[model samples]
Target: MRACHALLAATLAVAVLLVPVGAATTAGAPAVQQTPTPQVDDGAPPDRPVEVLTLADDDANRSATRETTLDVGPAVGAATDAAGHELRTIRALARVRGADDPDAALSREFDRIGARAAGLGRQQRSALQAFADGEADARTTLLVLARVDRAARALENRRERVVTTARGEGATVPSERSVALARELGVYTGPVRSQVAAALSGAEPPARVYVSTTPRGVTLAALTESGYVRETYRGDLRRVDDASLTRSAARDAVAAAYPSLWRVRSAVDVDPARVSTVRMTYDGGELAATVGSRNRRVFRDAHRQSLGVAGTDRQAVNTRDGFRLVVNRSYAGGPMRIQLRTVDGDPVAADLTIGPEGGESSPVGTTGPDGERWLLTPDERFTLVAIRGNTVVFITMDPLAAPRTERP
Candidate 1:
């Protein structure tokens, strides 16, 4: 009977061990798994497997042999359950952070635009005041005003684009009040910019002319379309403000330097120690000359003329110092030709030398009746000196082909 009772007790323990730890008991409570103590052959306890409720790492939690249940309290001052209240708070904070991030970015962007607008406003005001004060000539003032107009237009366009993009992206941009004020400011500035453009239209002249004050005298230069200094005069300024005198000087210099630029406008740069000079540059050649005051003598033979005939690769001519000479290089390694003619197209027979200065003079060549003759040399950079009855002209030849004109 005792053996039968012992066998029945063993069966009951086996049934309890077979029950799942996650299962509910008859009292509707979770069954906790109790860890059994480990045994060792040497009579010492071994390390048992520990079941931990991990605060991090979902994989460990998913693989846990025992289940864990937590009952947290409600959020502070809230009536809802703790989990639900905490979840709602988390969602609300996430939304607030999301909105704040873009809002902060928008604020920074608009602030920069606002600063640019303020600076542009100051520039516009100063420009207007300068126009009223006649601080510079009409052309200079108009040029400055035109630049301001362009800058303002650019800013206005960018502001419009920013507002449109922000609206499209559902972003919180500048406030309605700020936008309205900006629009009002735009309205005020529009007419001002337009007025400036109109004033420029009436007051603007040809390419800018500059008169700069120097330590030695005064300088007058015409700004070319490509921003080059078309220096017209550099000489003593008996009267720094003498427009007539400067105009005359410019006329004389133009006549001597670029006869074709007769209608050129003038800008003055005044200096005392600066040397005054004039230059006319062509594609393959350049001519330069030193000049003095308005009373300075002009070169009588300073006529503009072509150097090479039609269809030549390189041609250059200088009609200054009472002479005319044109050198034409037909092709590389081909015989370079010298063509001398007067402004009237009469052939000028002259002896020509081609080489570097102070170097051995190349074989002399004389022009034919047609003012064309070949010099035996490679197409390269070398000085050409032509002499005829006590008259000498020196010209440097560049092999590259570029067509340009400068005058006496």
Candidate 2:
């Protein structure tokens, strides 16, 4: 009997020891945990709603302006008015194109005027250089310089009018100034015009980028819905709108923000949406997502995955007008905290998910009264996708690098 009792006691001890080891081993496995909601006093003020500024009107105005100025619509009809000014050298140069050429007369005139303009440009350069170098006195050389300047201005005006005419008539000119200069240098050729035309036609319009300098860094806003979030990276923030110019500016802004940390691998224009979808990859796998948008935003992840995920399969419906979701994924790899609030700091309720980076996420059971959730993940590294109404935020967390903070 004493032997049997001793053996039973030994077995119990071994089981207890084995239990702890299994628990510890499974601690990092993906799981979901709910945080208890604190009792609210009836007298406490109701949570103030967050305000998302309306952007539709302003965006429409910008879109119209961009289309009219940048879109290659119908070929501009020939100028109704004749060339506004005549050059003294108009009769000097012979036509490069034969009479059989459709634009023989215009070509001849352009060459003559171009030659005079080039000579004037050379003279102007010399005069400007001499004055800059203190070789010519500001006062003593005033009269001689004035006459030369007047003649040059007259020639340039004539050249401008001719160039305008060429553009109106849908003719290819090297440039506002290049054609004239090239002709004077005897470098004008049929191919030059063709090349110039091709370039002008294919050239992308300037990107409209609005840069607001912040204390930490700069905010590159793209004026697109995707660029509505306010997050920090290398002290800089980013968001976007549409137009070829804005797209380029967004790309340039990201490159400038954290050149050592992130890079824009590609930016493709979505003509239908008039916005650009950009891919920003980082130097290290330390960050999961690096881009933020109006509906959804991703943070810099520890595991470098492309910014923004593919498809909307897991997207959360956002609240139309409420607090913007701010996520602190500073926890090295898995799990992060999410808070819904306005730029001014009002908290609101939201639904959220915590999961492994690029894997199925576990739902962080309903938010507490404080509009906060303790996003839990099984893996050390994870992503949190939060949704409140219509807004969504995807956050990548690195628990290893997460700031050490005491949990209350």
Candidate 3:
């Protein structure tokens, strides 16, 4: 009986091991295998993957990777983590060499700072991604982005000084790869910072953000409920203020830029909190204008003329002296091409100026053997005077007047 009890006890222990903890068995029912549910950290949702876009170093060379989607967080994290490792390695190298090696020390220092800046850039991109994904709020994201911008700008200035010192000492300058890596960080951060600033200033946050990298820098298009808002950042970390022109000031600037246009009307409702794109109505059509912050006095028109004959327009004037002047006007205040030819269509080289005879005039330059000269058109009403060795011909150009077609 004691032997039997020992065997029974052994069997019970085996049963206990087979059954899972916290599992209950019902009498007269077959045992069921219970698979344990996997536990998630902090009970948070699973990771949502996002596609991050990167621009190639050469803008003209297009590659499949240009459109390839990547998980931004992991990609950026890996890059920054690698930079950090590089920094540590650089520091170790610096420590090995004695203090007497100033050149080596300076080179290592330059590399270290570049790595640090790249790490900060990684943080900035992560913050922007979080804000875009609704994982973080605007205020927190903006603060982080602004801090990174300021830090990066300071580092840029510091790097310039280091370059100067390295040149003076005849030491090695920072490697081009390292410099490019640091600048690449700015390319990603600058545009996002601008978007965040716009959002903080009461512009609606974009529903979806699309990024494209270019040779110059980066362009970001934010899709909102209203429409797509596009902005380009060339990696210049300077602070940009919102458009500050009053209605009257904006109108005056446009008028001055297109003085030849009669009844030039300003239709732009200036927004103090955002960059305003100035739109003006003229007698015949409407055009867009961009005002510069440094010189609010000047306005640049946004219209462009096509070079192809399908949509190109031209104005022709005939002189009694058997000369024909063809004006290919560009957008107002843009490059206007003047072609001078004889009545028989022979190209003629002639000197051209802005004003009519005996008026305040400026030289527009001489035409080439092909009888074509491109120059900037004045904003006001002006006469294009062409002189070819005492054979003088002039025509008044008014942008407000519609172009008159000449029969060939």
Query: How many residue pairs clash (N, CA or C atoms closer than 3 angstroms) in each of the candidate models, in the order given?
Result: 28, 46, 0
| Most lDDT-accurate candidate | 3
Clashing residue pairs in candidate 3 (N, C-alpha, C atoms within 3 angstroms)? none
Per-model TM-score on C-alpha atoms: 0.23, 0.20, 0.29
**Which residues of candidate 1, in runs, are more than 4 Å off?**
1-100, 184-188, 191-408
The C-alpha lDDT values of all candidates are 0.36, 0.31, 0.42
lDDT by residue (1-408, candidate 1, tens digit) is 011100010100100022333456768743433223311121111111001001111111100000011112211212232344345334433443456465554455456556666675565445434433445443443344345445545555555555555555566665553443253234223222233333334432233222221222211222121222211111222212211224346446535444433333233232211122343444422333333333442211111112221224334545543345665543221234577778777888877666643355564556767776654322234566666665555554433321212321
Instruction: Tell how far residue 360 is off in model 2, in angstroms.
Output: 83
- Cα distance off (Å), candidate 1, residue 354: 57
Model 3 TM-score, 2 decimals: 0.29
**Candidate 3 global lDDT:** 0.42
lDDT by residue (tens digit), candidate 3, 207-295? 23333322233334332333223333322212224344566665565555544432434344442211223554533334444444435
Q: Judge candidate 2 at residue 155 and give its lDDT.
A: 53
